[model samples]
Target: MKPHQQGTERVITSLDWLAVLPVGLLLRQVDLTGCGPTCITVSRWRPGAGAGGLEGTGLCVCKEDGAVCGSDGRSYRSVCALHLRSWVSLQSGGERIRKAHDGECKLAPVIVVSPKKIHNVTGAQVYLSCEVKAVPTPVITWRKVSESPKGVKLLEELPGDRVNMAVQVRGGPSKHEGTGWVLINPLMKEDEGVYQCHATNMAGEAHADGSITVTEQNKSKKASLLAWDNPS
Candidate 1:
């Protein structure tokens, strides 16, 4: 500090820089009523490297090797970047990133499955399933395409008179494996359409299309006999 003729000048030495300033070390400039130049005050502060430099307030300097999993189901280069992005998201009034994990994220659900397209006769049985694996068990639902050319709707549980509900692997409580519904005896016309299996958890939702085609037994027999007789 240099004492001039008017007031005292405060100077922050480079070696005195600290990462954080203590509350007691904090100084404020306030005008004292009827106070002369002798009461003048000078406040100065300098942040160190650990404090993210002078303008590093609310900012982070991430390490190159740092990695973190964001609640938005994305892997970030560093925790600092993740927090910075989260703050940006909040400022924009969008969905906030709620959680973060170390060593990258491996919690989102994954669907390892295939679609089934079947052609069967009337009064035949069929099964539709969807396979999903995740840290948290997923919920499975079935939907059938409307015959009236409309969109699909949620397939509610049956009356349980014919065991029409879905079945799980070894009857486990979780519907993780290829668990799905059972059609006891589907009609040729009433049951021929597209069915869907949807699996959902905290991560996301996945869908698989199942196309069922039921044909009349008599129609195939008559066509086969006519083709055999004409040898065409």
Candidate 2:
């Protein structure tokens, strides 16, 4: 603030957009219309993010055109928090929505596997899993590095089965939306090849891979009668 400027101290708050919607909008009617130093509104990064952590975006109340109100988008009573929560509604005049459109915080579903280090035999069945850290449970699919595992003898598959989604994938619970399972059933010798886990959601697909080794069993016990015979 310049020496000449007075009453321009902005109000800061801890509430997120969702928590401050109903009353925060009212800040515009009184705060902006007042005849004091233009209220310079600002806030601490997401409450839970802690003292120094800042994950969400913010708004700046600039005194342009000799007034808190200006033609350049900044001239709003309220700014919808980065993602347009609520209190942000009145202070920034919906800046959050505009930002969301221009700069989305979408999380591309990423495939993460547990026990990333796995070893299997030709006749052993293997199990791999993945989850998208993004919102909206993504579609989970399986693939082979070499080729699709189609046309396999399902009945004779090692572990005697195929890896497939156990349940219809939908938006996982809010906290674990992009989560899913990848099951490899009746793993076989040819199936020893590497397998890829794919999870796709509206945002995008995330990828991860796991290597598989199929150790062949030793030859059967049958031996030829003439084997090791002394040559005349």
Candidate 3:
């Protein structure tokens, strides 16, 4: 057989050399010399070209005036931005989307303005209220500063029932505020002392004090004289 001259030929042994688009689309196959239309994937290009990233796409505008701390431990410029970020993440099949909370993430304990000192006569009902503001919602406890070294006791931990007691502790009717303790029926002299309110949370603890003065009950002079003169 006579040998016939043939044109040079090329063979693409693998698709490994194909460039991968950011959205996971493979480039079109072509001859090694390279002359053909590029394969265009509308769906894959849509995400990278003008959709889904955190920047641009009008995804992070500050719709409202409040900032928030996301569960990811970062502060978002605004609530709208946070929600938008979450939506993008969910749409992109990224990590689970976490929406941010209303206020900046913080833990602070503050005692509202309460009377510095309160006076009540024997057998009078008095309420010593302490309002606390704290993140994570603090636990409210009332204690009396003791003259002895035994320290104070949580009012709820006091022995026996509070049905007939010098003091009783309770929470506020609404959780939006806080709690307090009441001196239900104070004794003439026994209940006179300094009381403290203790608030605790994951961040730490805080306390405030108020003085309670109990005055001696007054006895009528005529009744005293009559009792002395009668000598039953």
Better of 1 and 2 by TM-score: 1
Estimate candidate 3's RMSD in Å. Answer: 21.3
Q: All candidates' TM-scores? A: 0.45, 0.42, 0.46
Q: What overall lDDT goes with each candidate model?
A: 0.52, 0.44, 0.53
- Per-residue lDDT over 1-232 for candidate 1, one digit per residue giving the tens place of the 0 to 100 score: 3212212223223211211222222222222232222222323324343553343122112233356678998756555445545656777797777446775565445656644888887766777655666545667666665543465454533323434334443222353343545454545456677776677777677777778887887887897899999994
Q: Mark the 10 consecutive residues where model 1 has the least summed lDDT.
A: 15-24
Write one digit per residue (lDDT tens) for candidate 3, span 149-187.
Answer: 566443433213655344343555444346666555645
lDDT of model 3, residue 20 = 16
Evaluate candidate 1 by giving its C-alpha RMSD to the native, one decimal: 17.0
Candidates sorted by lDDT, best first: 3, 1, 2
Give, for candidate 2, the lowest lDDT window spanning 10 residues. Answer: 1-10
Model 2 per-residue lDDT tens digits across residues 1-232: 1112112322334433222333232122233333224234544344445667543223333332221222223322233332223334557764323322222244567655432546665455566655556534566665655633884422221222444223234444455355444455555566666556667767787767666775554321122223435434
C-alpha RMSD of each candidate structure in angstroms: 17.0, 13.8, 21.3
Clashes of each: 0, 21, 0
Q: How high a TM-score does candidate 1 get?
A: 0.45
